[model samples]
Target: MVSKILIFMLWFLVWLLLSWPPRISSFITGALVSAFVSFMTMDILVKDRPSGRSPLRYLWFVYYIIIFLWECLKANIDVAWRVLHPKLPIRPATIKIRTDLKSDIGLTFLANSITLTPGTTTIDVDKQNGYIYIHVLFLKEGCPDHDMRLPVVSKFERILKKVFE
Candidate 1:
């Protein structure tokens, strides 16, 4: 019940944020939409599980968002530098990386994070074996060493493991 309310409130807040200069009519509409969606999806959203009930977990999710934004900024700058440089210093490579995340939600989050970044795209995911194939725009020389871990991938996976697993 509490989780349902939280999900409803989250959805309404997002709607409000997206609908700038919120009017009374928009507020009512957002409320109705949020309520309907929440009622329909609460079970799937909250998973009827007790693991993520703590307020501390919410705080951790906020912390993860901050870290993700910072990484996004860095990736944007890196990609911009590569694009504007005279030599076009790009060493593209498709590499297979192993993840420790067990849940589908966690793995999906990791994959989306990789794709959201400027220079990396998630090519494929092998959920059974816990492998994600990613294509990177700027690869260092002597890369693709099977055991190498990319900073963006590893850091986001570490944070998401805490958030989702």
Candidate 2:
């Protein structure tokens, strides 16, 4: 019951933020939609609610958002530089990397983080083996043993493991 309310509030907040300067009609419509969606999906959305009941996890999620935004900014700059330079430095390759995160939420977060980063996209995920195939725009040459755990994935995964797992 508490989880349902939280989900509804979160959905309403997102709708309000996205629809800034919310009018009375929009507010009522958003509230109704958010309530219906939250009530319907509360079970799946909050399946692991007990594990994430701690307030500390919410704080960590906020911190993760901050760090993720910074990383995204850096990635954008890097990609822009590569695009503007005369000599394109992008060495695109699809590499398979493994993750230790066990939960579906954790894996989804990690995959989304990878895709959100400017230079990388998650191609596919092998859930059974915990392997994610990612296509990267820039790959340094001769670094055959280069760490596949990109900063974005590693850092976000660490925080998400704490938050979800």
RMSD of each: 2.7, 2.9
Q: Locate the minimum summed-lDDT window of 10 residues in model 1.
A: 48-57
Model 2 spans with C-alpha error above 4 angstroms: 14-33, 48-53, 141-148
> Cα lDDT of all candidates, in order?
0.84, 0.83
After superposition, candidate 1 runs with Cα above 4 Å error: 18-29, 50-54, 142-148
Tens-digit lDDT track of model 1 for 24-89: 999999999999999998778886453544557667888888987887898889898998999999
Q: Write the per-residue lDDT of candidate 2 for residues 55-139, one digit (tens) a residue.
A: 6888999999898888888888999999999999888999887788888878888888888786889999999988889998986
Candidate 1 to truth, TM:
0.80
Clashes of each: 0, 0
- The local lDDT score (0 to 100) that residue 47 gets in candidate 2 is 71
